[model samples]
Target: MDIFSNLWLGASTAFMPMNLFYGFIGCLLGTAIGVLPGLGPTATIAMLLPITFGLPPESALIMLAGIFYGAQYGGSTTAILINLPGESSSVVTAIDGYQMARNGRAGAALATAALGSFFAGTVATILLAVAAPPLAAVALNFGPAEYFSLMVLGLVASVALASGSLLKAFAMIVFGLILGTVGTDVESGTPRYVFDIPELYDGLNFVAVSMGIFGICEILRNLEGEHERSVGVKRVTGLMLTRQDIKRIIAPVLRGTALGSFLGILPGGGAMLASFASYAMEKRISPNRAEFGKGAIEGVAAPESANNAGAQTSFIPMLTLGIPGNPVMALMVGAMIIQGITPGPNVISDEPALFWGMIVSMWSGNLMLVILNLPLIGLWVKMLTVPYHLLFPAIIGFCCIGAYSINNSVFDVFVMAGFSVIGFALSKMRFEPAPLLLGFILGPMLEENLRRAMLISQGDPSIFVRSPLSLSLLIFAVVVLALVLSPSISRKREEAFTE
Candidate 1:
């Protein structure tokens, strides 16, 4: 089918009464959770995975996608009002958004974040539609060798873009490779690392690992820092933009959208990287550079727009090639697997309704977020007042339920609690959990593809270099590794990611 026909099919499915309602519910729940400190889309989606088991694939995906993008919009509310960044992507937003609020421009900052995000989401949705199909078409030509090379490039790119120590990220990737081996080998039917435990024959549960690392560990961290956060302004005034405000933001928003759309398509580059890059670029080239940390509207507009755009476009690789660009997309992968859908290039042809419907739901979710955030700003602010002591118990209880529901086994809950301790320790050591997740998600796929490539070549290592596409991908991976480890480039990466 042509593009228009595809969109029509998607619209019809997405706008069905039930699907639309689920999308709205996801946005509502996503916004509520994202406005709370320490709970981002990764945690939100991981905790909600089991609930989608009873729904149809299309409906389940529509809701999951809604939660991912809606959290991007919700995170700005906390950043602007209370100077607390609810998501890592919103950290830059807090620098200027909070300053604007302190200067009695709270309403304007919130409005800028909402409107800019809506505009960026609209653009990125279009990009996703135009870019994904062609990419998938190209991917249809891949052999096992090519697929293996692509996974290598993806893993290397993730390590390059990961925050903090490069060596540590590499270590995490190796560790994940080891963890991924803890199940029965597909070829040999023999357990590799299960230690004779039947429950682990399928490997560690995805829900258990994600919830413990993202949800339970985050809750533990937040509990230790309980305090009453103050809102800079009790009353938000003048939400509507003036001619001057509109003139100042137009270019920055467009530039940010472009940068974000590009970055979101790269491995490990999602809303967080896009926001940081946009902020850095704006600081260097913006006309109001001197006013950046002092309540500049451009600071609030650029990163907020960039992050939303990145969030939407990051779906491209996941849908087209079964590659997750970041941890949030990784959780979406888990959800898709739960629904018995394998993520790959063929999904567009095999599950067009699910693919197109998810694309359509992004636009609807963004629209819902704009409407919900603009008039109901005070409600989100009020939610921030709930004490931690009353909140964490519910979070832990829900995580426990999610872990157990994955397999109807209490062992999964124990596994989750164990990982929470590991996750907490890693967080304390300043290691980013995202690369570990990327490694974990890609490890099995990498091993399978590599084995296939080897068998096809009859044990010839030259098969990887003999194919032009495979050779090119490996060359690209080498280039990325060099750039990531270079002294000057590594220094710049550190500076860019500094909070």
Candidate 2:
């Protein structure tokens, strides 16, 4: 009943004409980016953050949330049509989806993806509504010591789950933390790394930093391998699934939704991980296992469902605990900060209309994707035909403009350009940028909480251990790190990423 009331409040806000318009625009942009290969939701959002400054917080967040999930719907289009995954999570979708297109079952593959994603998104949204309140309630009880421990667990879990070398991930996290220390010290007005520059006193703008690292850096990388992709698909038909096709996909969709929901709650676990894991699981146990890479509908169904479910559930920790599970969520945290709203447990109580409205808006956004995508398939396919050489220049120009708009200063633009160079160098070294972004976002919070806990204990180091909740969190983080280092688990982790 309370949930229903909250949802009613949300409906009043989400269904407002202005909010619906914003959500539609967000879905439209999200689909466009998802259909275009070199563009992604993270970079798109980072570039657009400054533009949302004048909008109400609820409208801004709802629009951003729409983009995140809408991309899941749009990414499948390229996977099935051209065999080029528009987003990383769609990589598995291409395996069977492209084969289906080659076999002239492209329409069936696309339909399965749409239906599976819709079901999964709905389930995950409901799960978020039910689970978030209790989690926030638990978080509300946390003190400085517990909050610090929770952050420690988040950073460690991010490292354990990140793909590639553990040492590199640690190095990136440390580097990000170092970058975070550049601003004026909050407790003492002394500047740590400002170097006499006035702009450095306030710290680097995250919007500019993210724009350079993700948006500009991506443009640079794409330029090195720039080439036009031919659209192999001309026309599609037979979108309605047969009874036999429906029967085969039911179990796989259910399994994927459950698996993705669980994994999404873990730090560093998101759509890409869920899609790969679900596809692998279906391959082992699906009755149509032999048909996995041969245009099997089950293959298309499971990964699509898992990815959408994972995308939705990944918001849980970000909204409830102020811990971002991935780079996209980190950007969302940045958006909230830009809106002058603190993200965490108190958000639900202090801003019920905004919180509930955003949740309700996700469902509406998913519906808009389904209603809009099928009819707009032709437009999306045509977008893929646009050349990268022409596309990259426009993107770089927009990123530069966006960076300069942050504070109406050219310094931020320079920061963005400098970070782009740094990001490119890191990519060349095979270091994952995700951990670095997470570390940068969490570093100051971690430092603040640690200092507060120390002050409360009068500088006694044993205060962290004295709190049972804090001790448990620390123990859990250590165990996770230990498991990641263990030989068998390490091998499995590598295999998961490689596959």
Error of 2 at 310 (Å): 0.5
RMSD to the hidden true structure, all candidates:
1.4, 1.0
In TM-score terms, candidate 1 sits at: 0.97
**Candidate 1 local Cα displacement, residue 429, angstroms:** 3.5
Question: Which ranges in model 2 have alpha carbons more than 4 Å from their true place?
Answer: none
Count of clashing pairs, candidate 2 = 0
Deviation from native of the Cα of residue 195 in model 2, angstroms: 1.1
**lDDT per residue as tens, model 1, 106-132:** 899999999999999999998998899
Worst 10 residues of 2 by lDDT: 372-381
TM-scores for every predicted model:
0.97, 0.98
Pairs in steric clash, model 1: none
Alpha carbon lDDT at 307, candidate 2:
92
Q: How far out, in Å, is residue 487 in model 1?
A: 1.9
Q: Given candidate 1, what's the lDDT at residue 419? A: 88
